[model samples]
Target: MDAVQVVAEPRRREILRLVWDEERSAGEIADRFDVTFGAVSQHLRVLRDAGLVTLRQDGKKRFYRADREALGPLAAYLQSMWADRLDTLAELSEAAERAERGEGTDT
Candidate 1:
């Protein structure tokens, strides 16, 4: 699966966030959630398959870390797309606030 499709799963997204800045063992990653270690491992496998993470083996432990450089293209595209959407959301939210305040009423 592609990086975008792999990350579309919220659990996988959470896992990504956990290891974004540092490598963590499979057990460590599993501890962050209530799910089974196998479940987290599966997510890591998906991420690895998508080139979003790198796995290292160390004496019966598997460590996973975010492979951000590998996702440069997708990240750039997502940033551009979200920047516009986030700006629109902010504007709409501000408009709602103004309407809720009755157009600058002194109350």
Candidate 2:
């Protein structure tokens, strides 16, 4: 699958984020999500097939890290997009808090 298609899934994007900075064991990555290990493993496989993540095997454990070089321009795009979303979410949360406190109501 192409990089864009591979990262279109939310879980795959999250998986990329998890391994962006450092290599992590498959089990470690799976622990962060609510889904079953099998699901996470499937995501890992997709990422591997897309060349977006590098895999390293040590003994019986598998480690994964994001291959930023493979992502190329998509890395910057994803970062910008995620940052914008986070900013919007934070604004919404703050507005909700103000509404709860009766501090920003127009009425």
Candidate 3:
């Protein structure tokens, strides 16, 4: 699956959040979840395949971290969507305030 599709799952997104800033081993990530280690492995596999994360090998350990540059498009899209939603929320809040103050009431 593509990066967008792969991250559509909340669990995978959570995994990304964990590795976003720092490199972590598979075992470290699995420890954060209540699910089985195998399940976490599968999620890690998906993230790796989707190019959303990078894997590095150090001795016997495999570390993972988010590929920030690879997430540019997705991040921009999400930010735009968030901005739009916030704009809508602000408009609604202002209208509600006006109603509360009886400044724009039709009644």
Steric collisions counted per model: 0, 0, 0
lDDT of 2 by residue, 7-103 (tens): 9999999999889989999999999999999999999999999899999999999999999999999999988887898999999998999989989
Tens digit of lDDT per residue, candidate 1, span 49-93? 888989999999999988889877766664565578779999899
RMSD of 3: 5.8
lDDT of each: 0.84, 0.94, 0.86
Native-referenced Cα lDDT, model 1: 0.84
Q: Ranking under TM-score, best-scoring first? A: 2, 3, 1
> TM-scores of all models?
0.68, 0.84, 0.69
TM-score of 1: 0.68
lDDT of 3 by residue, 1-107 (tens): 77789878988878887897699999999999999999999999988888889999999988999887888788666456557878999999988999898787564
Which 10-residue window in model 1 sums to the lowest lDDT? 74-83
State residue 30's C-alpha deviation in candidate 1, in Å: 0.4
Choose the strongest candidate by lDDT.
2
- Scored against the true structure, residue 82 in model 2 reaches a CA lDDT of 79
Worst 10 residues of 2 by lDDT: 98-107
For model 2, which pairs clash?
A: none
> Candidate 3: where is the Cα deviation over 4 Å?
76-107
- Candidate 1 residues lying further than 4 Å off, grouped into runs, are 76-107
